[model samples]
Target: MNLNSIHNVYFIGIGGIGMSALARYFVANGKLVAGYDKTPSEITDSLRALGVEVHFEDAVSSIPKSCLNSESTLVVYTPAIPQGHLEFEYFKNNNFKILKRSQILGLITENTFCLAVAGTHGKTTTSSILGHLLNECDVPLTAFLGGICENYNSNLILNGTEVSVVEADEFDRSFLTLSPDLACITSMDADHLDIYGDASELKKSFVDFSKRVKPNGKLFVRNGLPIDGITYGIEDDSDYSVQNIKIENGSYVFDVKTPKTLLENLQFNLPGRHNLSNALIALAMAVEYGCPHRQLANALASFKGVKRRFTYQIKTDNFVYIDDYAHHPEEINAVHQAVREMYPNKKVLAVFQPHLFSRTRDFIDDFAKSLSQFDELLLLDIYPARELPIEGVTSAWLLSKIANKNKQLVSKQDLLKKIHESNAQIVLTIGAGDIGEEVKHIKKEFNVAN
Candidate 1:
């Protein structure tokens, strides 16, 4: 299955962030690219703008005739696609060369020097930062990221063929497909319990991923994670660590202590100590890839963040609005830490839409505790991405566990009205669901009030 032999690339779930990145990659490489998604989205629109034909309909007829050749056309699909999907069934029955998104990433990145970032959280941001650092350092690199990079304004970063940076996704064990020259596990938090069933299994999967690093390649893991790798952490003992960190003029100013030397006064614009850890891991990896120390520092300063990962929508003195894709308890805790460190006195209002019913059921207590840190809370019903509704798992049930007195469950229709009525200075909408689609409206409403 040589990718060079393929003339057309068809995606079954092209609207997904990771899938769209691959679509862009194929289209950029001069291949005929088209796909079907369940719904139209900004991502699909962007792919279409790039000359990749995208249709929202799921009917088998929506697939282009160009993709009919089973041998020359590559059919890629996300695991989230249903087993009964029409286009999927068409490809399956026709004996098309089908590949999972991760398998395709592995195939494309095999010959290149791959820097794979793997974890339950922070994979997107870490990979995006690494890509930016390499590009700024003038390293000939290409990065396939899982989120839209604000600096490049695309999930796929292309420069040269020598190096490839990618997000090593853990969902559906996708990261296992990648054979990385250098890999980092930013976190191994228990998630996707519907898949792994427990935290230990999730940890074992990460351990297996770490072992997948090439014999001579490097593996970086966050400190204290249950794995053997060169460790990274914030102001702690690890092979690479950030120390003397301070927020200066709205950016994080810190020093990274690596195995060889201490890179001082490193500047990262992203917020949070967890982000600082992310930056440190990216910096270390870039240096290992032969990027100069000074170059790493410069790149860190210029690296813009990933969209929806602690993304600041509005940053004015009077009002601040942030949007994050934190769907788990550990991620929410990181967000809480960032907000408290930045605006200690400001009243914070959090609007969270739980991602899946299974996750909500597994970590309801943890979610309740993390969300309680907010001064006020507005909880939306679960998003249920690929899960059937579990009995007794509802956002209202989770909201009831929150200790905050200023908490209520609200519908999307009344979300804006509730925000307008609140006196909180820092407003955050946190989730890994359709809540992001509402960010623009929330920002517009705040701007109009201002």
Candidate 2:
């Protein structure tokens, strides 16, 4: 449990966003870091560039010999790794110290003034904003984010360690492990049904997370959530609210009404009202943490946003392409709203890859309704991340349920051709899966044509 005594750190699924952040933290702390991932990715490549050993195979021999010592080495594994992974088995049977990702995160932040952001959605964006705000205010902070922040171009923001900001993930009820000094719940939508089984249980998990805040700590909640806390919302009478919203030159210009005073003409460059809410809560938390309001305003405007959360790959007057990590139905609807609001007269072509089979099956009707809003749709096969496919839960089946006659199921190979055939002015690649890998190619092809 004493992290300072550990000399080496090994990760089982080091390529994951969260795991990679931890790996970077260890590397920055001068640890001998090594790990195994099922596949090589941009993350693994970056880790290797930092001189951490990484391999793709699951064999126990792939582990560095330095990481074999039980006393000096700490082994970390994500829940997504299969139970029978050879490296995992070897570490367990050899009496090595093993910890889940969340446990390690909890231990790292427990002593610091921790700021945790929890929700089914908006965790990454909200935490990233908070981290940027605190860092800009010259707080000694280390933030472990769920996604790479565009401003920093890194998931682990290590300015100093006096304050820690983290995404309090609710996936295995993971956020329960951290006692935060300041925490916020951006939303409590029904999600991760594969783990929680139902919506009420998921709500209960958020409530439990709220209690994990220290007795002297503050908790912030989205205005409409069931929990009682300092509330934030857009264009409403919450404890903290935004009013007089206007979009000029594609950036939101608004005035904030805090519990104490009116802060006017704040600017945020992110697109959606969801993002506006995210920025609001981060501002509220920072203000309560004693950050100067003037510095917080500047930080909010300078935040470029987390990668793949509504990233624009191509933007021209005649054509546009956007990539986003929107897997949930609510997330997709938010993307739809942002796109429609930005380009009201343009025809949008949405290329979507459904993420998990269980999620797709559970929310098929909702997905259909959300995707139906697009002018044209190209549906790819469901990306089965950790589960085997359910019997009838294919993208083709989901396509059939969509009310839009312009929708078709397409293969990745044919995807570009199908996209080129469409006359829509706006293009979006939406998913949390491997669809992100296709962004560079799409951007390159479209940019050349334009």
Candidate 3:
């Protein structure tokens, strides 16, 4: 538990977004770091650039000798890693000090002034904004984000170690381990049904997380969430409210009403009401933490956003291509709203890949409803992450349920061809699976950028 005493650290899923941030943190602190992942990715390449040893094989031989010491080396594994994994079994049987990624994150932030963002959605963007805001205000803080912030080009924001900002994840009840001085629940939408089994249980977990805040700590919730906290919303009576919202030149210019005063004409460039709400909560938390309003406003305006969330691959007057990591139905609806608002007169073609089989089965009707709103739809086969496919659950089945007449079930190979035939002015690639890997190919096919 004493991180200072540990000289070497190993990760079982080092290429994961959250896990890679931890790997970078340990490397920056002068630990001999090495790990195993199922595949190579941009994350693994960046870690290698930082001198961390990473291997794709699962054999125990891939582990470095320095990590064999039980007392000196600590093993951090993500929940996605199966229990039958070879390196995981080796660490288990050899009496190594193994810990889940969230447990180690909890330990790292326990002694610091921790500001944690917890919810089913908005965890990544909200926490990234908070980290940026505090860092801009010159607060000595270390932020561990769940996604790569475009502003920093890395998930781990290392300004100082006295304060810590973290995305409090709810998957497998991981957020329960974090006891924060300031926490916010951006949403409580039912998700990860494979883990919680029901929506009520997921709500219970968020309630439990709200209790994890330290005494005298502040908890902020979205305006209408079923929780007691200082509330924030777009334009309503709440402790932190945004008013006079206007979109000019593809950016938001608004005003924020805080508990004590109003911040006028604040600007944020991200393209969703959901993202604006995210910016508001981050600003609220920074304000409550005693950060200067002028500095926080400046920081929020400058936040570039997380990489896959509403990232514009190509933007021109004739055509637009956007990529987003919106796996859930609600998230998809938000993306639809933002896109339609931005280009009301143009036609849109949405290409979607369902993330998990269980999730697809759980919300099939909602998925169909959301996807039906686009001018055209191309549905890819489900990406079964950590789950076996259920009988009668497939992309074709979901596509059949879609009320949109323009929808089609398509293969990855023919995706670009189908897109080429569409006359829509705007195109979207939306999902949280290997669909993201396809972004580069899609970008290359466009052959132009604005």
Candidate 4:
């Protein structure tokens, strides 16, 4: 089970954000790396550019000759990949040493000084910020993030093994695999009802993840989260709190009070109060880990943020365009609050693509209420990431529940035209699906039309 003994690393779903990060990690360490994904993306293309051979097919013949060695090569796959996958089955039938992506990650970070960020939302931003802060403060660490970091342009942040940062993913209960040196649970909202079946089970899972922190390690939880830990929030009584908040030149300027001291006049460029909370937890964890105060503040200012988390695609005096990876009701609510706070009177048009049928069914009412807050709404059919369409679950069905008069369900083909027809000054493309793939076209069309 020693990673040092393996010379070749094969991934069944290499193009996934988390999987690609691991693939990059292996390639950097002088190991032969290759894998398969269901489709090609910028991520996959980047992996190939790094000398990792990636194929899109699911055939057994697609497996490389180098990876066929059962002893020297490690097989890693994401839980999202089906069990019936040809390469997966071949690996199992041959008695190959196969592991889930999380298992491999846990093995890598188990003995390191691990800082894990766990949540239904904000994990990427919080972890990415913490990684950036630590690296900027001259801490030697490796971070495996779930989204592309705009500053680094890679999900894998490479340094030394003395410290490591990771996204403690909750899906498939993956975060439980790691025993972290320090951890944060940002918000334990009800999600993955497909897996947990209800809210109480999801809360229990967070509690389980909380206990995975090392014996002497610290745990940080959001102010209202149902757990016992060091708490953080904005303008609230908590272990770490942000106060004296103000917006200067479109960025948030705030102060954080920790248990020991009040860190004042912190500057963060991201757009929401929720993001401010994310920064606070990152600051608290970094300081608790012994990062210097002045250096941590400097890095927090320079941190660009994770792509697709309230990412501003285009920002101008007369027009504003945002694309966010908010697939849940609570996340969309955060987006709504941010946009309304930033552009008070401007008309906003939201184009949303629900991510999964099960989620859509579970939070149909909440989604309707949040999406209705926009000035105009354009919804696409649900993006079925890993689930088949559920009976009676459809975008049109959800759209009908919205009380907005300006709402309509639009196909991807006609989406640009609909955007052109809308008079909203702010345009948002919100989802956690292939809707992101359309951003290039939307931006190009906007440039051409303007």
Candidate 5:
């Protein structure tokens, strides 16, 4: 558990969003870091530019010579990596000290005053805002975020060790490994049903995570989350709440009512009421940690947003396009709500790539109902991240249930051409899949046409 004993750090799935953040942390701390991934990505390219050796092949020979020692090298892998991964097995067979990404996170924050953000959907945005608030307040802190913060341009926010911030993920019950001095749960919707098997079990897992907050620490939950703690909501009876919200120049300006004080004229540019709640949670956590209300408001104002979380690829006078990583039904519904608010009565086309086969099977009807809200739909094939295809679950099958007559199935290869042919003024690319990799191409095609 002592990180000081580790001289070299290696990763099996080094290119994963969360795993790459840890890789950056190790490299920034001056550790000899190297790793393997199944493919090259923007993350892998970034790691290589930092002089950390990264390989696509999973062979043990690809392991750097400096990372082979059992006593000094710490092996980290994501849950997405299979149990039979060769490099992981080699590390196991050789008795090298190894751990899950969450275990290592627990170790890093074990000594620092930790602030953990846990939820089914809003954890990344909340953690990013919280990290920005702490940084703006000049706190000695490091935030291990789930998504890349656009403000910092990295998932791992670099700072001194007095305090630490992290996204407390629930997959594989990973958040249970953390010891947090302060924490917040944004939402407790049924997700990762592949792991927990049912909604009740997933809710129970969150309750267990709430108990990990250290004695004398605070736990903030969104109002009505069924947890005993300080609560935050928009226009609700909660410990922390937002009031008098209004949109000004494409940004939301609102007032906050906390237990001790009421702060007004808070501004956030991110769309949706869900995001307003996210800002409120971050503000609540930072205020509890003693960040000045004035400084927190300034930080919230400057917060650009997380990449791929309602990201704008093209926003011009002629056309508008947005891409999001909203895989769950609730997330898609939030995207729908945001779009409806921004472009009400305008023709909009939704191009969605369902993330996982298991998730599609679990929420087929829900997905259909959510996607049907748009003016038109172009459904892409499901991105089977780690799961094999379910027998009857496919994008075409899900498309059939959609109540929209404008819905049709489209392949990724044909996506751009299909988009260009559409008469709709606004386009939405929504999903948590490899569809993100195609954003650059989509933007380019639109730019050329315009």
Candidate 6:
């Protein structure tokens, strides 16, 4: 089970965000890395640029010959990969040591001083912020993030061997595999109902993750979540709180109050109150890790956000375009609040692509309510990532529940023409599926219009 003895690492679903991050980590550590993905993507292209061998075909023959040794080569696969996947079955039949993505992450982080971020939403942004904070402070840290960080332009950040930062994902009970020295639960909203039947089971998973923290370690939670941890919130009486908030020139200027003292004049360029709370938790965790106060403040000030998390594609006075990976009701609500607060009185149009059939079925009412806040809505069909189609779940069915009169279900082919016809001042493309791949095209169309 020793990683040091492995000479090669192969991934069955290599194009995934988390899987790509681990691929980068193994390659950076001087191990030969290769993988098979169902499709080639920007992530796969980036890995190839880094000298990792990646192939699109999922057959066993697609695997490199160098990875044939069962003892020296370790195989990793994501939960999204099906049981009948050819490469996966090949690896299993050969008796090679195989691990799930989460299990491998748990193994890699076992000996390091780990800072794990867990939540139904905000796990990626929170972990990325913590990674950037630690990196800016020059801490001896390594971070395996769930998204591409805009600051480093990579999901894996390696600084030193002393500490590690990870996004504790809750899908399929993934976060339970992690043993963290310092952990935070950013939210406990009901999600992934296909995996955990109801909200109570989801909350129990978070509680279980909290218990996985080292006995002497600390856990940070949002003020209202049902968990025992140091609380963080904005303008609230939490252990670590953000107060004196002001928005000047589209940036948040706030002060953080910790148990010992108040850190004054904290500046975060990211929009929304949710991001402010994200920053506060990151700051508190950095301080707990012994990062200097001034260093933490400086890091927060210079921190750039993660890609697809409230990412600004085109920001101008006349027109604003944002892309966010908001797939859940609560996340969509956060995006709505952020957009409305930043550009009051401006006409806003939202284009959302539902992620999964089960999720859409479980929270159709909630999604309808959250999406109704938009001035205009463009709904796309559901993006079924890993689930079979639910009998009654469809984007049109969900769209029918929306109270907004200005809503229409559009195809991807007509998306650009629809946007061209709209006069909305602010446009947001929100989802956690292939909708993101359309951001560049949408931005190009906007640029041409200008």
**What range of 10 consecutive residues in model 1 has the weakest lDDT sum?**
54-63
lDDT of 5 at 153: 91
Per-prediction TM-score to the true structure, in the order listed: 0.98, 0.99, 0.99, 0.99, 0.99, 0.99
lDDT of 2 by residue, 1-450 (tens): 789999999999999999999999999999999999988889999999999999999998778889989999999999998768899999899999999999999999999999999998999999999999999999999999999999999998999999999999999999999999999999888889999999999999999999999999999999999999999999998999999999999999999999999999999999999899899999999999999989988998899999999899999999999999999989999999999889999999999999999999889999999999899999999999888879988998999999999999999999889989999999999999999999998999999999
- What lDDT score is found at residue 317 in candidate 5? 77
Please, what are the lDDT tens digits per residue for candidate 3 over residues 349-390?
999999999999999999999999999999999998777889
How would you encode candidate 6's per-residue C-alpha lDDT over 239-299 as one tens digit per residue?
9999899888889988888999998988899988788778888889998888889988888
How well is each residue in 248-294 modelled by candidate 4, as lDDT tens digits?
98899988888999888889999888888889899999999999999
Clashes of each: 0, 0, 0, 0, 0, 0
For model 1, which pairs clash? none
Winner by TM-score between candidate 3 and candidate 2: 2
C-alpha local distance difference test of each model: 0.91, 0.94, 0.94, 0.92, 0.91, 0.92
Worst 10 residues of 5 by lDDT: 337-346
List of clashing residue pairs for candidate 4: none
Model 6, 347: alpha-carbon shift in Å? 0.3
Scored against the true structure, residue 267 in model 6 reaches a CA lDDT of 87
Local lDDT at 324 for model 4:
94
